[model samples]
Target: MPRSIDSFNRQRLITSYFSVTLSITLVLFLLGFFCFLVLSTQKIANHFKEQVAVTILIKDNAKSADIAQLQKTLSVAAFVKSLQFISKEEAAEKFSKDIGEDFVTFIGTNPLQNAIDLSLKAEYAEPEKLGEIKRELEQNSFVSEVIYDQSLVALIHENVNRIGLITLVFSALFTFVSVLLINASIRLSIYSKRFIIKTMQLVGATRSFIRRPFIRLNVRLGILSAFIAMLLFSLSLWGIVKSYPEFSILVDAWILLWVFLGILVMGILISWGSTYFATQRFLNLKTNALYY
Candidate 1:
């Protein structure tokens, strides 16, 4: 009968340990996922910003040599991410294809102007920089006009700022919630052994001696939980990369490494701190208080 009771208690203890470890692992995974999103926000924004193209239309009488010189100059500019020259013939063909008719042939002339599609670097995508670039390009003798959607540029800027602010707010809120959750799990696990702690104290165990094992055990649990969380996060990231290969370019390996390390350190610190404080609380309680 005594052995049966011991077996049941041991089983319960193991169950409790597993429960606490699983809880911590889930919380850490969510926190780490949010951290990764926060870190990659800027990169994602830049990727989209660089896709907005500014078109420079060429004058009909522009010499080929002058147009080539202009292309060479713009290609090396600090603000330019990439540029593609579209000849008038290519523009006419594309328009004809889109309309399902050869408008150039019908009119007996190709009216489309030669143009250069310019994609600016992320930093120069702002309204002020774009305005300066447009003015600069329009000053060129061979350039007829510089054209881009001003409203679209403004909209992108507004949306990026809004998204960044919202992400930061959610990151902070989730971090607080994660801390609370981990702390609660640790306290509950310690509570289960409150009687053992008191018994040890009654037997003349020093406070540090009592805390050492609990703290060490919880720290190990914390590290294990962190590893589990990181594994789950890596699998999720892998799935994302598989679905959208381009997304992999936005996430830096060093940033991911740091996030993983942060999770490990956070797990260990929170577990040790929570366990120490929970055990300390029980240690300071009166023997009679144990019943309540």
Candidate 2:
């Protein structure tokens, strides 16, 4: 009976060790998911920013050289995220296609004006800031006018702001819930080890000496789980880019780097915090409580 009891205890310990590891892995996964969500949101916001167009109407007789120069200048503008030039011929063709049935015949010539299509950065997408940017662009001598949907831009900016706020709230909520779950998991995992902690304390073991191995184990678990989560995120991103090639920019090096670093930080922080609290609770228990 004594030998059978010993085997049972041994099996229980091994099972609990794995259960704790799995819990930590889950927490790390959640953290990475949240990081990816944030990065995706920012990319979506940039899509909106790139869609806020400002048309730069050129003079009827503006030379090709002047238009080329204007394009170069607009490309370098602080507010501009993207710029494209539309020649009179292309504009006329587009208008005719939209109107249908040879509207070009009534005009006899391409009466459509040449223009530069400008997409502003998100920072300048705000209605008031955009108006100021438009006014600045209009000051150029070759620019006949700058035109875009003022109300539409305003609406986009407002919607983006609301989305940003909602994302922040959701992230906070996820974090809170994740932390609580981690704490519970760690407590359960460490509960079985309480007797050992009390025995060490009775034997005059230093707290640092007791904590070092556990902390190291927690750190290793954090790193491995975080790497796995990041790998999954990368795979998901690659699949998305493959399916929708137009959004290739979302999988750019900079964005991927940001996501990787964010996941690592989140994993390390949450794991370390959960382990610390779990160990603290164990150390604080009354000696008699360990037997329970």
Q: What are the runs in model 1 whose C-alpha is more than 4 Å off?
A: 202-204, 240-252
lDDT of 2: 0.77
Candidate 1: Cα lDDT at 71: 92
Which candidate leads in lDDT? 1
Please provide, for model 2 over 1-292, each residue's C-alpha lDDT reduced to its tens digit, 9 standing for 90 to 100: 9999999999997787667667766666666667666767777877777787888999897788888987888788888888888988888888778888566688677667899888788788788988898888788777899999988887877887788788878888987887787678767777767788777877999877776677777667677767877777777777988999987765657766877887678667777877777787788888877777
Residue 65, candidate 2: C-alpha displacement in angstroms: 7.4
Q: What is the C-alpha lDDT of each candidate?
A: 0.93, 0.77
Error of 2 at 58 (Å): 3.5
Give a tens-digit lDDT track for model 1, residues 244-282: 998887569887998899899989998998899999999
Per-candidate TM vs. native?
0.92, 0.82
How much is 27 displaced in model 1, in angstroms? Answer: 0.7
Q: Where does candidate 2 stray beyond 4 Å? A: 1-10, 59-76, 107-110, 137-144, 240-247
